[model samples]
Target: MVKYVEGSFNEDYIQTLGVNFMDKKVQIKSTNITFLIWDLGGEKEFINMLPLVSNDAVAILFMFDLTRKSTLNSIKDWYRQVRGFNKSAIPFLVGTKYDEFVELDFQDQEEITQQALRFGKAMKLPVIFCSTSHSINVQKIFKVILAKAFGVKLVLDEIVNVGEPILVYK
Candidate 1:
């Protein structure tokens, strides 16, 4: 997402070790909004940084790796911890690595999709599947966040079919 907002992509992978910050200004529905992004590292050791990240946040992205189902299981714990600090923070269930996810077998894809949908429904969050490398549904994440935050209906259509990037927010 940092790359997407920055309008560039890097081939090399540099994992977030602790926390990183990036700011971007965008025009959505003719409204210019500035977004201050905090990229907290996703590691048990970095869980201590939750208070700093979750405090006063408008939205919380509970993201998991689509290729790794175990990551999805961790979402429950993360969401619970974040909710402790900010119950009103809008939550989003995000599945990353769609480029690799679509390459998996149909059964695997269906299983993951069903599980993600169930989890999203349970949390009452908008579910979105995206590939940062491919820029698929990357910008839509923030756009949906803004629309929901301001109670505005998005004009974009959602794609929910299997074997495709899923964007379910109704």
Candidate 2:
């Protein structure tokens, strides 16, 4: 993971490029399915530093607490910002706290879901609501992203076997 902190412009976050070794090594006869994952800054002040959104990104994962309607509502502006940056219409949407929503008011829940649906329709992207704390549908999120980005069909044969090894080409 490479951390980029362009402090002068109030933007700071980490970006990582790697392969999911848990799955087979792509079995590629020629090239690797390389990827770039940008874990962007969530701070309001840092939002401005995002580079122009474009198709270079495979997906954008917007995560927010399900118990906080305010936070959920805030995603719209962020979505616009991201959409503007991502001019190519790559897949993107909100990821809510699935389990945490049990504690939120019913009205808030409906509103959030409505907002999510509205945003999804407007952006032509699907909204994923899942919980990481309880490990609910966590793995599926990556699967959806992978399917959308690569247009490849994948099923869970088994958990991917990830190891630490650096490949060298002569």
lDDT of each: 0.89, 0.52
Which residue segments of model 2 deviate by more than 4 Å? 1-34, 52-55, 153-170
The top-ranked prediction according to TM-score is 1
Error of 2 at 145 (Å): 1.1
Q: On a 0 to 1 TM-score scale, where does candidate 2 land against the true structure? A: 0.63
Candidates in order, TM-scores: namely: 0.95, 0.63
Clashing residue pairs in candidate 1 are none
Residue-pair clash count for candidate 1: 0
* Model 2 C-alpha lDDT per residue in residues 55-102, reported as the tens digit of each score: 366566666666676766777778777777775545655454566675
Candidate 2: the clashing residue pairs are 22-160, 22-161, 53-85, 53-86, 54-86
Q: Mind giving the per-residue lDDT tens digits that candidate 1 earns over 1-170?
A: 57666867677869889888888887878988888788888899999999998898899898899999999999999999999999998999999999999999999999999999999999999999998888899889988999998898888887778888999987
